[model samples]
Target: MERFKIRVIVTDQDVEKVALDVRPQTVEELKEIVRRHCNLQYEFNMMYEDPDFGNALCNLNNMDEVPAAATVKVVPLITSVSPEVTSNSSDISISSADTVILPSSSRTQGWPEVFSIPNFSVDVEFRLRQANLAYLKDNKTFKCPWDIKRNILQVLSEEIYKFDTYPDENRLHEVARALIGKHPCLTEAGCTDGCSGWKNSLYYKMGNFRTKLRKAGCAEVSINSSKNTPGVSKGLKRPKRCEVNFLPELPEREETLEAVRFLLAEEMKKKNPNATTVASKMDQTFSLRRREIVDVETPVETLKERWPALFTERQVFSEFNRIAATNLNDFFEALDRYTPKFVSIFKTKGGGVGETLTEFLQQIDLRKQDVTALRTLVLRGLPVLLGDDPSDFYKTCSVTDDDGVWAQVSIGLLTVVDEDAPVGPNVIHLEPVSTAIIIEGSVIMDDLKSLPEALCILFGLSYALHLDYPKSMKNTLNFIQKVMLGLGHNKLPPKLQSLKNVLLS
Candidate 1:
């Protein structure tokens, strides 16, 4: 097996933690596949280097040692020669500047078991250009495999302005999680094992609001009034749906509902010529309206109340209170300091919640015939939202099947049993988006495999269009990030079963 180096860039932009090294091996003949497996052109590129690090070919027998995963320490090299030339070549030697070593304590323990392909050789040939760096410059390295306040400062900006440097462990974990690719929880004794290195009441240990992040998945409840409900003298009425009052509406896959509203209104007018007068009467009845935006400022008193959640003693809060003098600006600053904590608490997916809904319905026995109808009714209005299927992959079903598009979708099935609250008629369900696309289904799924059945259920659910569509272009960028984590460095497809041990270990 031939070993090739790989570099994954973990940026500081709104991320928790990321790693830099991986080892992968491939055949010299079908080398192009390597690019597909890990490259920026696809969803896996966000975590990759523009000038990727890997060999061109894999030697035989040594196949087991393929460079499936490695963490990288990205250091910027400024040389006398142009930076471009240095990257253009396969390798370049640089004069030593300051060296930052990972102190071995930084690695977390116990992550999940992931998979990746085996090692291979490289057949690359390139000339090396000179690389240079000035000794006067400062260098930074992260996750130095160490646990120390000093080292933490090393990774952050040196020109220290007074601010709360400590977020919580959960927040820190999440920040690390976002910044790094598939990380382990931190410890004084670092455990590099992805899934089973260490265990504790991590969620409970990190208590209070300071400990929780948005990713822990907040509970949401929506209150809405409907006109079709029973009235004092009226007979039984048709049920109306309750809507969610959302802030900065949840994101869409590709198309906007606003674009189609005009046409729909026109159709309604055509169907009822006297509709204007009827509409006036209809308006007098209950109508839909946008949720009112609340501009109430987050209070300092609220922060003071929440501040104690981060620590045992009020010392840290007291120190900040001393500086900010109990003012709103100080509270806002405190909130910013604690922002990192907010992320870590949520990113950890919180329990087996993904399985909770399914577990509740595990005993259900849906006959083949019933599932077919349920799927049909459930996906009725989602054609533009769920997306169309390509020959192979779904290829972003939420976007318009129009020419160029990118679509991202998150789907789940919710069960219904109560007669009083039977699943009603909305084929696909979605919340408004501030970012990201989320889709929900209410069908029993013992067999979502048969091509005909899958199509029947999923085809029309594409109502909102794919994420690849133009309106959702910004959110689609995240697809690249998630895909990278799902398949890049140490992440291999199911075929590479033999290499699974090392990936999660």
Candidate 2:
């Protein structure tokens, strides 16, 4: 057996040499050996010089690939390193000026879980490094300067905006907690959790930050400004569900609002407009349309006149993709995937709702039903099962009275059933059933093939036109938003969680 000597570098001053009797097959095996020899406890990455690339330091993944007398550098994965920790090796040097490498775990465990925080400015990084050093060296709480705190808040607010335009208290707390977790030196000594004060500061900072963003023509924040939402509260115009791009900023270096509007109008005039171009233009003008609908509260008719392309099915899906950052096809696929499980769960119930669900199931041939019909059953049955009154959302009426029935519904499925078909207490044989989406007492989309399609279009219109979920179908809509679409940021409500548990089980 031959022994290979390897040099392990922890820091500029800390180096250890070890002899290996047999070559380690994997990186983990080598890491274990280095960790034992150096007594290293912190998570770190091992970098070895690659002779092929001017001996540049590269991540050590395969131990067998290491050169015969390679020197490995151990880089601790830390967010804020104390200034006392120094590195002098030319390949990997650490200084007060360089940005500290953040731990990979922080990406999953840190605040604003949906979005990653942007790198802090060099000045802010220097301040954080100093704060960490002072706290570690003096063994006393370090107070962050006001300017540094402000800059930190600014960076955090920008990242939060990517996930939500107006983050609520819960969201704010997550950011605060993450800050302290990453840099314990910044924790407030007076607070019980050491983060409450930070959370409060973040709340106020976010308000001011939104104001600044609004001034900069950020449509997402501007739509909720005091001037835009009158008589209504700040949250009224904000996204009720987790909408990642509820109203994104206008495209960079694109045409002005008026110019985009002109281009959009011109595009609508073409008999065979390019779909790729149309989608691109529609994406560019999303924020503007959102402003008109949410801020101006423009009437649907007026909006249709102004943005004719928006009412089309293609644009409706496109607008939904922009708001939720999800594809409609994936949404339907999820709905279908869970339909059988949902039906099984619904069958176990034993109440008025259960009986209703049973009737619904009886009407449909579960084994032979198409995906559309299965989805329709799931979408319609969900409201009833969730205790949300579906009388208003999924209304059934004869062909003669559908117009009156549809007119009464603000937003929901208007199923036109056959008048002559056999009707039971809660069962109506749907033959050649037709479903339409009623928005603001108007059928914006008619002859929808399935109730699920109508529901999808209605959900999209809620974001596209800035309409609220109808009071009667709030729970069902919330289920689709949170569970089906997977847009929720918080824990599911009791009933929703219960259903989710069963579905997963």
Candidate 3:
């Protein structure tokens, strides 16, 4: 390895001298050394005199270009406004070759003696006290150092008078503009045409440096930890809202669940315990509908892991799907059978028959009788698929059609259903209604002045259920329409009337 002796000079004063066996790899390493020796809050431009090029900073990246011995001059980007020490101090040199240099004032609080800026040569000390910036007085071109890019923060922390402690956010804009006006270098890059975009830069710089000073024990006590610290609010929390599921809770379809369980048990009797072999078999079995069921979680993964032998040649997945499909098909058949009976009940309650979704919506008025009749009929039909009462989940957000009622309903559904978590057989279509409504963008509005109560409930439920279980609820919507047509001012049956009262009341 090559070796070089180097001398670092700060503003014409010798600050450091060292012998290096390994040359610095990048300009940043040189900057780091300068920071260690000079305690400079702002960055410096490390320039050297080149024998052939006259004067310039050597790119350390190309080792062949560097000389055996070099003299590096440190030029501060943002010169200190005032020196803490007088110009004639001979003890300005900090000669410890390996010790890290820190600002004299950086010592933690309670030292009894307040530390300020360290002394420097008379020339450098006097130059800082003058009104003009050091670079401008020397007529040198601006070499914008990365570190000094945001040093305005340190200036505001140490020099600004109105701020007795850390400045509040309210004064940030004013301070930023003032600092930019005072120091031209603080102006944002590419803003040379009378536009100084330094406000954001100064604001962020000051905010970060304030925190740094506090952690370094250099921040003022008044602004450090007061309860009434400006720009910060204490003891505030986010507001809470009452949330209820829009889909009602229903009794479990025990017979249907039992059938599904029975199918799985039969499949387990045939399948091998090996997970890999069973997974391969399933992959081949569902090749046609593979895409649809690809992401579906295998509910039997735990059982397969614990007792892989029971799954030997098992048709668990196929049988479960077959049973579920059969149950769903049976539900549609029942809807076909019981639909006419419900239609008879609806007609006796005085609801109008509508051919289209729009017609149904326009006719439904928000009368107690109309709402009760429609709600009762829909709830009755819901049991065909759900096999239980869904009244509890009928809650909705305050927002109506315009704001998208399904949005709130979906949120409620997600809260109730942990889709990622494993569930047992009792988990019935967790968000069927809400999921369908969300995808279809359907909602029910209580617009008594324009829309009718019977039609609103009819279309709302029909659209939601039809979208949720398209194949199973295919004819259910038409059944609702027929029921509405049959309702023609005849008195409601006593059972339906009581049910209507339960809904509307």
Model 3 lDDT tens row, 1-505: 6677677776433457767677777678767866775665544466665767775665344434556787776764432222333122332322211111213221111111122323333333343334236435763334444433333234344433212233334344455555445444334456553223445554555554544443443323212334335567553111000001111111224354334334444444674544555454343333112111222222233334433332321233222222111111232334344544444444444322222222322333425334333443443343333223322223233222244434444211111223353332223221222321122223322222211222233233322222232333323333332233221122454544443444334
Candidate 2 residue-wise lDDT, 1-505, digit = tens: 6687788998665789999888788888888899889965345789998888988899988877697788889976544432233122112212222223211111111123433334566666766777777878885666777556655665676556545657778888777888877777888889888889888887876665565455455556555555454355745567666666555544443348658777887888899888887787786777677767766789987888788888878899978777666776667888978988988877898888888889888878877876776776787688887778877777676676747766877887777767775533355334446777777787777777766777788888887887888888887888888888777668778888888788889
Q: Which number leads on lDDT?
A: 2
Runs in model 3 with CA error above 4 Å? 1-153, 161-170, 183-197, 218-505
Rank candidates by TM-score, best first. 2, 3, 1
* Candidate with better TM-score, 1 vs 2: 2
- Kindly list the per-residue Cα lDDT of model 1 for residues 1-505, writing each as its tens digit: 5444444332222122222233334333212333333321111112222223353322233334433443332223222233343222223212211112111111111122221111111111110000001111322122222222222222221101011112234333433333223221222234452212222222222222111211122111111112223344242111111111111122221134333333334434454434344333222211111111112222323322322211111222322222222221332233233323322222332354323223222322334324433332222211211222221222223222332222232332222122333222221222211111123221212223322233322211221111122232212222211221221123333423222232233
Better of 2 and 3 by lDDT: 2
How far residue 338's Cα lies from its native spot in candidate 1, in Å, is 47
Score candidate 1 by TM-score against the native: 0.17
lDDT of each candidate versus the true structure: 0.24, 0.70, 0.36
Candidate with better lDDT, 1 vs 2: 2
Ranking by lDDT: 2, 3, 1
Q: Against the hidden reference, what TM-scores do the models get?
A: 0.17, 0.69, 0.20
